[model samples]
Target: MVWAWLRIAVAVVGFSGVVAGFIVNVDRARREGQDLGLVLANYFSLFTIVSTIILIVTFVIAGLWSLRNPGRSPEPRGIALAIAGITGPILLLGIVYNALLRGLPSEIALTDPSGIHSLDVWATESLHVIIPLYLLVDLFFASRRRALSWWSLAVIVAYPLLWLTYTLIRGGLTPDPSGAHDWWYPYPFLDPHGGGGWPSVLIYVAVMLVVLVAIGAGIVAVGRLRSRRAAARTSPVGAAG
Candidate 1:
């Protein structure tokens, strides 16, 4: 019951933040005479935004299941795997943003000295920090989860791998709407034409892939441990054994 409500709350907050940030961004771009179509395209292209939306959807589904089932565990094998898979990328979003992108000048004109700028700041924090941390907390402390197989790591890595491929291909074909560079990438580290060229971009991508897989492995291990503990608690020979 409590967990169901918590999941619902998280979904609500995430939905609100993503929508508000997008509106603020569109408005800012329009005010500055930028093309709205290009702005919307670039906005949705961000990994952070996509990952956050995935998280939001997962929680909404989980929450609704819990509410419907009441006392039963809402996370079956598939749902548990989905949660485990997304954990890595979502946490990576927070790690990358805070470590590399926090202080950088945003393309969204986040610093505008206007009334709605505060909303943008809050929205940014929700997407990059608040929701990520909440997911981490839920991953560790949620009462129920199913053990995942070793091969599930591949499933976990697939979304991010596809996202990277799409980002690079689209970036090559698209021009920067802001005219800041010939190509526009959501993050500078992934920009092939930057100072370190393709080599630098490859290095960054490799490092991030390694980190993401590591996070996934950790989640799988934790899920297995938790599943074992839950089983023991319900067995005839309990924790005393």
Candidate 2:
């Protein structure tokens, strides 16, 4: 009984990741001299196109994986993180990174292009929804508890937040090749200052930070309320035990 809303939320997050990837590539190409009006017509960046196809295939596989005996006991943390890092929207950045490289002109491919958007930025921004979706999935006849715990919620919040902070500190969210060549490459979404200019970079980050903070705060509040309820329920039981 996977919750419908969780499924929808997962789908939306994936869709948004794909959109961000595509937009970043297009923006990268534009900065590289592709005409804005006729970008698709002239742009033959085939690597990413094929990469996108692979992502679609991978996503299908991931969905199938999700449907297989989902109500079992908790998944090993490593496995879920692997799936999140490689299969889900979270991994889209890495995959798209490969695509970007493949899409580049060979002579200048190693030049390390700029980003159209930030992957870390997008994931953190979207996590405001994705984590709750996961919580709801946990609620779908899975957990006996009526709601999620605050600690559980905190772990969930840290997923995207931690990643976002890591990316920014290491120059992840921008398109500049300097950041691209690092071990954590392909973070077009995180590369704000690359071609967008300082004004654009500051503006986007400011707005994104505000929205993400608000969302994180709401999640924390919800978890606190649930924790209080759970504590009240447990007090009498504890005395008996």
TM-score of each: 0.94, 0.32
Compared with the true structure, all predictions reach lDDT values of 0.83, 0.42
Model 2 per-residue lDDT at 45: 25
Winning candidate number (lDDT): 1
Per-residue lDDT value at 212 in model 1: 93
Off by over 4 Å in 1: 72-74, 107-111
Candidate 1 per-residue lDDT over residues 1-241, each given as its tens digit: 7877898898888888889879887887777877788878998888977887887888888877877877645377777877877788988888999999898876455546567877778888988888888888887888666788888899789999999999999998777877666778888899888799999999999999999999889888888888888889878899567
Provide the clash count, candidate 2. Answer: 14
Candidate 1 whole-model C-alpha lDDT, 0 to 1? 0.83
10 residues in a row with least lDDT, candidate 1: 105-114
The local lDDT score (0 to 100) that residue 174 gets in candidate 1 is 79
Write the residue-wise lDDT of candidate 2 on 78-178 in tens digits.
33332222222223324334444335443223433553335534633443334334534433333222233334434433444454555456543223332
Poorest stretch of ten by lDDT in candidate 2: 41-50
Q: Indicate which candidate wins on TM-score.
A: 1
